[model samples]
Target: MSAITLYTGAMLQGAVITLELTAGATVVSLIAGAAGAVGRLYGPRTLKAFIFGYVETIRGLPAILQLFILYFGLTQFGIDVPAYWAAFIWLCLYGTGYAIEIFRAGLQGIPEGQHEATAALGLTRFEAMRRVIIPQAWVAMLPALTNFVVLELKNTTLVYFIGVQDIMFHARLGVSNSGQPLAIYGIAALIYIVLNGTISRVGGILEKRAAIAS
Candidate 1:
């Protein structure tokens, strides 16, 4: 079989693994992000300080460093883990920090008067946030959050560093098998563009909806 054929088949498995990592990481980021944002906004000063420190620390580190720290560094503790889990945990944590910032901006974007009005009308703080504040924050944050998720889709390739056999790895495998580096890597790059482009289009639609809501 030709190198292209061999790599093309490998690319299929790589795509599958890539999608799994993206989906898993996105879910984790969103859930953790929203919760963390709420805590940063409504939690006590100590909690806000803690969240701020965590966000700044992760945002400052290169993702490759984070992956290495999680995969090799953590494994030294005798905690059995696989490349898939390592990539999943690191990406989700990476995305979580950014998502927290996005969510914080969304929460702050809501008018202070809106909060006052909700409370003046007999709503408790929790009810005000739940019924009025969060809905609006979601609208404001949807665009940024969508963009973050699409980025997550691309970031799944980081799994290659930990040997997850992601699409990039498959491209390498195919090149090895067929000795056609040019065509194999070229095709792999095209697939990434296709995936991220679709996400960009979706983000535009969501942005429009958010604007309309506001």
Candidate 2:
């Protein structure tokens, strides 16, 4: 049988797992990031300080190190995190660190007059942020959010280090079994390129639409 035929099933399965990890991480990270941004921007001093420290600390650590701590080191603390959960959590936290900054910058980029106008209309803070502030900020946030998604998608490969059976893991298996490192690794690279390219294309379209809308 041909190498392509031999490896197609395993690669596809791996791709699905990678996509799942990316999707889950992206969603949770965005939610956490938005909340973190809001807290830093509008909450009291203590909340802001706490969020700032969390973001700085998470951003400072390398993701691989964090993953190792989650998967391996946690066992010493009598908390055994499953490899898949560890990977998922790592991706979410890592993405969130950057996402918080992206969202904060986007929200802050809006003019102070916008907030004033909302107050003048007697809109409560929650209503103003939900109805007026966030909608406007989405345009500014889209490009950065898109970049974050792509980065997270690529970073999913790191999950295989803890044996999550992602694309790279399957590629390694294919290499070992078929002894065709070039073909296996080449296919893995192509898969990533396609996924990243798709995200970029979609992001570009959204950006254009947002620009026209604004």
lDDT measured at residue 165 in model 1 versus the true structure, 0 to 100: 89
lDDT of each: 0.86, 0.91
Tens digit of lDDT per residue, candidate 2, span 1-214?
4876668568879999999999999999999999999999889999999999989988898878888988899899899988999999999988888899999999999999999999999999989988999889999889998999999998899988899999999998888889888878888888889989999999999999999988
1-214: candidate 1 lDDT, tens digit per residue:
4668767778978999998889888989988999899889889999999999989988999888988998899778987678888899998999999999999999999989998899789999889989999888888777787789788887887778678989998987778877888898889988888888887888888878777877
TM-score of 1: 0.91
Clashing pairs in 1: 3-178
Q: How well does each candidate superpose onto the true structure, as a TM-score?
A: 0.91, 0.94
Every model's Cα RMSD, please?
1.8, 1.4
| Candidate 2 Cα misplacement greater than 4 A, ranges | none
Quality of model 2 by C-alpha lDDT:
0.91
Query: At residue 161, what lDDT does model 1 achieve?
Result: 69
- C-alpha root-mean-square deviation, candidate 2: 1.4
